[model samples]
Target chain A: MSDIVQSLEGLLERLHIDVGLRPILSLVILLAAVFAVICAALWGAVRARWISRNTAAFWIFVSPWIVGFLLFTGGPMVYSLVLSFTNWNLIDPAKFIGIANYKEALSDPDLGQAIKVTLTYAVVSVPLQTVLSLAVALLMNVKVRGIHVFRTIWYLPSLVTGVAQAVLFIWVFNPSYGLANGLLRLFGIEGPKWLFDAHWALATVVIMSLWTVGGNMIIYLAGLQDISKDLYEAAELDGANRWRLLWNITIPQVSPVIFFNVVTGLIYAMQTFTQGYVVTHNGGGPADSLLFYVLYLYQNAFSFFRMGYASALAWIFFVMIMVLTALVFRGSAFWVYYESQRPRERRRRVHVG
Target chain B: MSASAKAPTVKAPTVKAPTAKGAGGPRREPLGGRILAVTLLVVGSIGFVYPFLWMIATALRTPEGVSHGGVSLWPIQWRWSNFTDGLGSFPFWAYLRNSLLSTIVPVVAVVFSSSLVGFAFARIRARGSGVLFAIVLSTLLLPQEVTIVPQFILFKNLDMIDTLWPIIVPTFFGSAFFIFLYRQFYLRLPEAMTDAALIDGAGWFRIWFSIYLPLSRPIIIATAVLQFMSYWNNFFQAAIYLTTDRWKTLPLALAGFQSVNGTNTPLLMATALVVTFPCVLLFFIAQRHIIGGISFTGSK
Candidate 1:
């Protein structure tokens, strides 16, 4: 067995696979071993009539994902956590440093600025987008002629995002000649340098983010259509005005949709990268004001070769998402009204394809 | 959507004809409110439409026309040469072929793998499938930032960097979000359909291949189109993985074009338009399927 193992290792080395890859390759081997064990156990169980045929089928069907989860997602997460504590440049053998990366991250001024910028972005974009999307949805739900045409046109901005969005907006946000400033000139208000101005760079990026709110608007339309029409009538009979009905009925009816948008918006805002990276030409922004947390993390990992430090930043981001998501979920009880769960909700939940 | 739209009106008998101005059953918006709403919608639509118009205009304009950017909606001179010269700058055909290979292979894999995993969770019975499904959903919250570095390291070690393998390989593994999407559709399918297949001495694969797939036309198209858009527009993965100019994707290729041809705004827009127009055209053609899939996954 030792001789066979030695020969196999020699064969692999001759194949030009790197030493750094040996760990992941071993992880893959371990995964296959575990899969083999599970298969043997399943076979034994089936022969002994310990588990049902249906249960076996489920496992067989689910096998690919289980293997994938372990090999790709769960394994990488665990590996990165380990990487966070070690000084590993991609080229070198990693040194085991003890919490040095995390300690340095706490004092890193760039990380501080990145965090501040990220939070400002999340705070500004989330609520505004949620409201804007909801308002648009409300209007969309109006039973007017040619509404779907308007809907299609509104959703156009959402079609192209990421790098293309940033590229198009480059001309749009140009100081002397771009459309944004030119439009502002129509009102005789001088526009800032927009993408070039440090004071305005973050705001310009925020506006770019909002350009695609029409995507959320589509969801809001669906939610609005889901609202019970009887509630509106009943509210009207009680002499409630349109404003009151909007405040009381329309909102509560679509609170679940609102909840979904807010959560996703928060998450997306926190990870704002492509626009900042593209617009800034991958070098943060004017005075690094547009340096988002993920951009900073990407720079550390790939650009600067500070892999361990980037991993530490990643962990910090993970924790923030966990805490923030949990908070939103916990607070959702007060605001979000799921019609299915409501005691007085009149209709049964029907599954729509 | 059709059911939701029709249901409230038929069931409740409250929503009146929208054209019934100031009707008693449903108070139509007053004249002032209607005008205000219409104005908002029109203004909002312009906000969305103008950028694309500008993009097209910029793409068609001469270099001098672009630099002399006045408030003109029409190009001073329609220069088709912008595209020829701009796309001619790099190995556009090579980059496009690279982009297509990356996109097509991954999209097909994602659809296949995700649907299989989703079917197991939806139709097959197991002891711990629920727990596994919950774990899958929770993992959706796991940021790519956390896994990106280690994944790169793993790929690097395997000598896969600068190749298309890194971008394409992960999609063969199931994406959690797409899994959840397919699972939702499969779960809502009647249990009797699978049971009938079982009674006919058929198996899980047969039922999935025949009944479930045939009935799932909308979702399959939606998933495919969405996946196509994602792969087509993706920049970060290409930036991280593909080092060579020859292997760059459309988005990365456009970025390179922008950097090198920075002075020629029209040429830059032309390249950007070349990258963007196909997707925008796709959105127009498959708007229904795209919206159906997105709004389906987006809400509950």
Candidate 2:
């Protein structure tokens, strides 16, 4: 018996040539099996006529994405919701905790601070970005030669990746060996340590947010183009000069675009993460002035392993965005023009039924 | 309904009167008006262009040269090697390849999926399309934070960890904003084209591909450019899904460069410029299509 056990051990040792290759081979086999299953399922879907021929072609073209969304998005969304109700530390059996996660997230002080900072950023950045974009777009709309080049140049910064731009701004706002301070020196003004100072750290982020008006400006330029030349000509005859024209004609015509920008920008700014993540040394800088809501959520999920709490925070964010967007749309009837609205109203009155 | 009935009655008198009178008049730009316009244009242009130029200047300055500039319009030494040195300093080629691979698939996926779904919503009489579309649109309202945790957990269980699936798969779902834009555009297209195609026994996909996609080049280009830029700029997602240095995208690589070469302002600046150049080149190339897309979205 001892000799048989010794021989078996020796054979096992001989078979174990490389430790890494086993896992990799197993993984490949698993993936190949999954691919086969996916192929079979897709073939069934096609053969069943559940999807039309044309639709089949369309789906085929977008098959990679559909699989991705199902696995990555749909699958994750379901799992996350399930996770939010569980007390899984990623190792042990997940315990059902019900609403405890929600309560904890609400009570978390860091979460509150992050929410406050994000709201403040949204309030400041969204309006500033929208107004500035419109202002710049208006200026660019003037019938000046070579203005297209100017428009292109102005938009250059927006095209640059946010990571690179944020990095550049960090240097610009650096107290020492930065251009912002150097510019301040020219005017005999001492520059505050922009990223370091707690009082101004959030403000520094706000300023950075505003600097990327190029994206919004491009959108506003599109809005400007929608303003028919006939409308401007008509306004001119009434002696409505540029300011008056802009106030009455241009503003009203592009009000819908403004609304689009405002709502989307508000949502975007409220969820501001990248700039906040990069600038704040990964924890909101100094005293958490730059702690954005999404950043907080990220910290909870990744850094703290509070997955359940983070999920609760995410749902809260979703609810908030929905409410805010609904409010905007509800109020839009006062300003947003719909060509079909009047006719629909008229048709409603004519309905005998 | 009550508000709408009253609106036209109130504005109808004003709109009609203004429309005719406004059409015949040649706009007269007075000396004061001309000066005001020029001044505003110059100021706006300066505000827009100055920071970018400053960024470029900072990029070209040497470590010592940047310190000496002190708000000077131009760099002192113009350290050209900063660009080469910046490229050499990190796993830039790997990042670029990953970014390129990642960006291309998503762009193609989104364009195809969005158009198909958009056409269904726009022109077809599919049951529950409106409700389905509304659901799709609602996805835009959900912040990325809400989903990230779930997404991460999902990927982990699926053993998609350390893979690009987390970043690439979401693009297949089709963007709510882009789908909405395409839907609006499809609405504006002459309905006769679709009706004729239908009469000829052409399927919905045929009409979409043969008719819609062909005619919508301007918008398609515009959307592709925008998505391309968005994908290029994406950092947070890449930061989360990708951990290994080899798996990093361009934006991640750029951020690493900043963190490492941070003390040398000139080298950092040069790197920033080089990183940004490709996107700038893309924008210039697709400027017309982009402008067209912008106008279309705005007017709607």
Candidate 3:
């Protein structure tokens, strides 16, 4: 492999190509070569009538995703798994250390802190965001004048990017001179040093996460809008009050949407990095209270150059997300009311009654 | 009853029109309850909107006034120079150009590539396509972190690090999520349309390009707007790859600005606002498509 690469470099250098352009030139050449080979094979297969023209066309159309999947996703996934067992920093030749990185993860204090902080953030923030966004959705769902303007105002905050939000909130939560404290002072109360305070740092991060609940609120509103009016009217005719209507009709009708939000939200919260990274100024915040799992993994990868260990951490995080998502899916079986299952549900109720 | 019957066919009624009648027949809220709901919404809107107002106000304040922050949205002293001075102090235009290039190219690339692939998946019945489609959807769950380390290594080996290639190139291959979105959209497209084109002896590419693509204006706009927001706001991959100033994007540059000038609140807010304005503007301009794209993904 080195010999082939060396000769390719020799050929490029001999051609007097600019050094920066050589990589790009070679990549183009490699892609062209692959394209030609695939074309030839496809042509041969078509001529031989081994595959239909539609089948051949399908491959040609989808080739971009296939090539990308192999190169970027599938290849890297396998490589990352292999790297998790090695002792490679970026500078060193990879040495197969055989689970040393994973073993170290078991007792690594920073890793432990990261897991704890991340889980706490996810646990606290996901449900709060789900419920809060749903509540806001219900509020916005009310048929009132100028509701669009109000909805837009509520959603505008979610448009701020993560880094910008973190920076803005740092100023907002400034220990002595910030909005949170300024408001607290107005109420004749003292606010803790928010991002600067050790105990309050993680909670501040959670609060920051809630600032973007408008995105999910819109989703819930859409779900709420889709509920058949007959369901509500029938329940109302049976003397269901507003509270009971919300509980029995609205909640079950939107449970699928709730399931979707919770799953995606949990996945997203677990991978939280930009907030912690920006808030802590690329360091763990306030004695590592805001040391999110991805941030710690990032530190290991880029700052510390522990590529192998970072890959191990990445896999562990991946598994944790998968397990959590699976648990949610398992639990959703009981609470998630699918409209398609209504027939069976009615039959079951009939038997029970 | 008439309004509720029309609701299902309207396709994204601006608001829940049926809820008015469905809550109870021709009912008005009690005056007290109405007042309470109004107050709650107003207060909630204030909570959501005040930080942004504070940001703008602080950006206009002198550095000293910023440090003495109060809950006032009124600046004591207007420092219009904060925008000029902040722009001058940082390479804002250069970063903005890089941001636009990375974002625009990917939006165009992903839209084209994903739609093509999505068309094939939705219309074509090749033997392995079902499994391939499944694989595409499954990739959506594979976290980017799981792939980032090796991808970094791969890009490094390709000598593409510290450049925009790592950030922009993979997007040309097509994104799993966007592909899925396009697939869902195309699947709903009537099969008769494609069959008519096919019967006219049009090729697959021609059918996709002429018939389906023209008909797919809504999904196209939705995907484009959504992609624009994501790529514009993207920080992590850009942070990993574009280590040099030559291709530093707005979010990364703003984060750098914050670190270097941590104490300069007015300047920081000015720069942050400049970085954030495009997304905010896009949201207002294409609010329907953005909201539709998001809820479409959720409901489906």
Top candidate (lDDT) = 3
Please give me the total number of clashing residue pairs in predicted model 1: 0
Tell me the DockQ of each model, to 2 decimals. Answer: 0.38, 0.25, 0.50
Q: TM-score for each prediction?
A: 0.90, 0.83, 0.94
Candidate 1 collision pairs: none
TM-score of chain B of each: 0.89, 0.87, 0.89
Between candidates 1 and 3, the one scoring higher on lDDT is 3
In candidate 3 chain A, where is summed lDDT lowest over 10 consecutive residues? A1-10
By DockQ rank, best first, the candidates go 3, 1, 2
- What's model 3's TM-score? 0.94
How far residue A261's Cα lies from its native spot in candidate 2, in Å, is: 0.8
Compared with the true structure, what per-residue lDDT tens digits does model 1 show for residues B123-208?
99889989989999998887777788988877775556787878887887788988998888877766776776788788888777
Model 2 clashing residue pairs (backbone): A234-B22, B59-B269, B59-B270
Ordered by lDDT, highest first, the candidates read: 3, 1, 2
Candidate 2 segments whose C-alpha is farther than 4 A from its true place: A1-75, A228-244, A339-353, B1-28
Fnat of each prediction, in sequence = 0.49, 0.44, 0.61
Highest DockQ against the true fold, candidate = 3
- Model 3 alpha-carbon drift over 4 Å, by segment: A1-19, A344-353, B1-32
Best by TM-score: 3
Task: Give the per-residue lDDT of model 2 (tens digit) for A1-353.
Answer: 22433354455457883542333334344445656776677578779977544444444433443454555556667767778787766667778899898888778888888878888888887888888888777666555567667666666667755888788888888898777898899899999999889888888888887777876786776666545678787777888776887677777777888888888788888878877777755667778888888888888877787777777777778778888889889988788764446698888888954
